[model samples]
Target chain A: MTRILPALAVAVTLSSFGSFTASADPLPSWVSSGTKDQIVEFVTAVTTPDSTDYVTPADRIAVFDNDGTLWAEQPVYFQFIFAMDRLAELAKQDPSILTTPTLQAAAKGDLETVLQGGHNALIEVVNASHSGISVEAFQAAVADWLDTARHPETNLPYDQMTYQPMVELLRYLRDEGFQTYIVSGGGLHFMRVFAEEAYGIPPEQILGTYANTTYEQVDGVPTVIKAPGIAFIDDKGGKPINIERTIGKRPILAGGNSDGDFAMMEWTSAGEGPRLGVLIHHTDAAREWAYDRESPIGKLVDGLDKGPGMGWVIVDMAQDWSRIYTGAN
Target chain B: MTRILPALAVAVTLSSFGSFTASADPLPSWVSSGTKDQIVEFVTAVTTPDSTDYVTPADRIAVFDNDGTLWAEQPVYFQFIFAMDRLAELAKQDPSILTTPTLQAAAKGDLETVLQGGHNALIEVVNASHSGISVEAFQAAVADWLDTARHPETNLPYDQMTYQPMVELLRYLRDEGFQTYIVSGGGLHFMRVFAEEAYGIPPEQILGTYANTTYEQVDGVPTVIKAPGIAFIDDKGGKPINIERTIGKRPILAGGNSDGDFAMMEWTSAGEGPRLGVLIHHTDAAREWAYDRESPIGKLVDGLDKGPGMGWVIVDMAQDWSRIYTGAN
Candidate 1:
């Protein structure tokens, strides 16, 4: 789609911050002279008219990876945790549902056993917990879990575990005429349950790994029921492919924390004209959980090594963020 | 995703009509006593605050079918015609590419023979013409086709065959805070090429049938190239399923011209609160080509038989539309 300039630019500011003033800093949670400066510089260069890097508002598309980029992904992905909890809940009602060894391990909260079984095992756990229900019911289940469930370590609500500075950045980008989308490896239905409230991104803008669904008429009402199979996994190479398939335009900016997002960042960086690839490096142990290259979940080896050489910005959480979780002590 | 009302509403109107006024009419191409009045009444009921049928702006999503709903699908689907032309162009370069009978028939413009070969044959013709190119290159090819390809019967550019009243309807809905989307069985990439230019809808808002794609690094640049396999067909039951998977919300209104879109209208009508299902009955044989119920292309059996009984607005193109093509005499 060839987009025209200026006409697509509307004053529909999505800043959670109050009306922007000349002196008001949009990203108040970000410390100066680090990732904040990099972001500001890139946005200004692309948005400022008469600059060679100027991009039209219609082409100002930005994508973000959810788990470790926008929020904390320690121990394991939050969606994986949600699946475990849901499996346990489902098993309590009908113990026979826990047939497979992976399902049994996941339902019993034996994370060690489930993790030992590998990626296929994790997918089994997710499919068992996530499927065989109506899309609305599954979303309701997720919403219910988020309402009561708390992180084992921080005890913070999963939705509230989102990074304060990252949320601020999302809002800041939207204010700069960029359409921000969450292109993550999280389950599409799982993320859609709380993404709008958590990150100010709508469900339509949230693209992620999804399960196969079948449309059926239940009780005289048209319904889409989740089925027991993975449709597409929006991770690694799949990220860029899904983005192109859905958005049809190469995003100008991409953000992620793990190697799973490397393909998306690479794709964005390779696009013509002004581009920015942001990688959030986990370095703030005291404020937020810190794990990087060797971490089982959200391992950052590729990003840490290759991102900078690709002119991508690697954000140091310890040095760049003045705040971690929103309103955290 | 559960949407919070009034807050989501913004003044991001996409009206090509100068400005809204009490005396100014929005649908000038539509005759007032028919489907236009049905649409106006429904929109007014849902949008007016304090009304019994009032709905939030966030829930005001309307979907339209492309081939026959938004434009004319006379002799056959326009995309099929595009495929035939594209196959001819490709065969001109490499004769061996036309190995199959379907390909040969399509390249030679023998529509009768191609049609006799059935749906699989059409798919073969399409996949052969549409794949093996970078997404950008394929879109460029489509743009080129729309620029030069004229509808054989009308001698008008293919893009110009769009209905003016439907265009106005899309803009009016957007002006009233509805997010209008094209949910068609037409090729996703093909529609995205001209959808924004012809209908004011961005690529992200268009959902349709898509081919399998592969991500590869071509000359060190990340590229998505179309492959020769049908990934998902966005028609019939697939329409509602795709909508649920992609948008994660049931649309409030759906407009289509045939039974292929029946599932979409059914899904929209079954949603809670104010709903509308619009079926465009092609009845203008004098002004425009018209066929229904028995026409192989855009056969309208289910929509004609059950739509009115379901409270769906059956738009009589002859009576309801004062004009067919945007600028046609």
Candidate 2:
């Protein structure tokens, strides 16, 4: 574990042109108050060696839940949107899957109908579209799709649509020697395939939902074939357990934006040592979209009610964040 | 990210009984002549920044096969031995299992009979014992068992019975900025529970076979409940895919001592740059048993045949290494 912070030069960017213009500073729009001060103070107190809240580098683990917290999850969860597109493409050949309730729902672009039976039905469709292919072929296919896939509403390429502040936050925390991990309700394999290219997070460092895959020797060459089973579900309550199971060390910092992340933030706040939990409230109605409590996507009203008791930091997106997306680079 | 290499004093035999032992050079005993020379040469060549073969520190990845490369897997693999012990202890409650053909065969302790069906049956016993348990409970159980579990022939605690030379080798390479990973055929969850305590390697760096597991909300607590299915088989050809899939870099250094590891070394050697492959040939019949080709456990005939042609360094246990087990305190 070597710190190369001093050796590497800090990159300074002054507003580059793209889908969205870069500002002089990322937090221009964020309203400052005790809320912002608390966050900055917390990070300073824990990270500084002299502070009472100073934590050793080993204990300085931070985890972030993706989707709504880091990026736009409108129209539907981005992955579900991708899966739906994939399902529609596959529906051309397998017309019979449309007869099945789950596949029929997905093909009909009905979220309730598709998620009706849940696990069994979703697995059937995922297996139909995602499995029985070589890993290389799968990776290339995903790469190609990701290169061209644009969000239906935002018209932003999915990758570019990431929250700029969170990306900067990830880099800033890493600069302070905190190992960052993404503990999401997303597919581990899919996230892993893009983590390095998209976020600089490596596969081994990324923990999420998974399926059992096998490696086989065929025609004197080795190939890994995806198996037909669910291995781990890294959503909701499973977040903390997966973090424990995979990383061993409990994170001192955790961030999220939904009830699905409530357990994670709860676990992080209750940890014995110094901890930080940040919740991104969907209050930005103009740029992106906003919904909570009654909405299906990223509901977090309970989280806000329960957060203060647990020492979680709630960031009203409208006031606390200056920027929304990173835009295309 | 502090590079504590200077502070990480190497372990040596303590001069008397002081808590702080005088540090020996973290370097190994093998004189830079044959195998050791080849290894050091390859590592140096690849890591030299100005050289044509120079690889970045990120690319200076090294993978090792655990079973034969790091420890003994003679009469039976240690984990299987642990499984056998677990099964026998459980047999008291279900005595009929002891008399049943499968359980009787298992209890008799003849590994051939115990694994009569194949790897799937082996996993069947393992899953029941390892899954649905608290992470702490599983870890404590492993630590407790390792404290007392001894090889039948040597009667030494399996933990202390690890290959001392290889242990030193790991430190030596790590000191030189090589990130080492243990690629093994053992159960992933099982190995993960103990790898850090036994080997000083982080859980994130350990790759192995796994069974299916799921996340569950139990009494409002998040738990990864083990499911009844095979996930990934991190053995043979699977080793390379797992390495590439997990590590995302071609190793500059690789080591193993079995046909199961041949694919891993081949994958390493196939890269178009300076790289080293080492096969640990157990040749000390006096200190321990030795077998290859015909042996079910730790077979190395294929690795031996292809090693020289592939520019791999084969280290004969009795010849290249001066010490067998240092029994590091």
TM-score of chain B of each: 0.93, 0.86
Q: How much lDDT does each candidate structure score?
A: 0.90, 0.73
| DockQ, all models | 0.65, 0.28
Per-residue alpha-carbon lDDT of model 2 for A266-298, expressed as tens digits? Answer: 878776767888988888788777788977668
Off by over 4 Å in 1: A1-20, B1-20
Shift of residue A55 alpha carbon in model 1, Å:
1.5
TM-score of each: 0.93, 0.79
Q: Give the Cα error of residue B133 in candidate 1, in Å.
A: 0.2
Cα lDDT for residue A177, candidate 2: 83
Evaluate model 2 with DockQ and give the value.
0.28
Worst 10 residues of 2 chain B by lDDT: B9-18
- The docking quality of candidate 1, as DockQ, is 0.65
The alpha-carbon lDDT assigned to residue B166 of candidate 1 equals 97
Model 1 compared with the native: what TM-score? 0.93
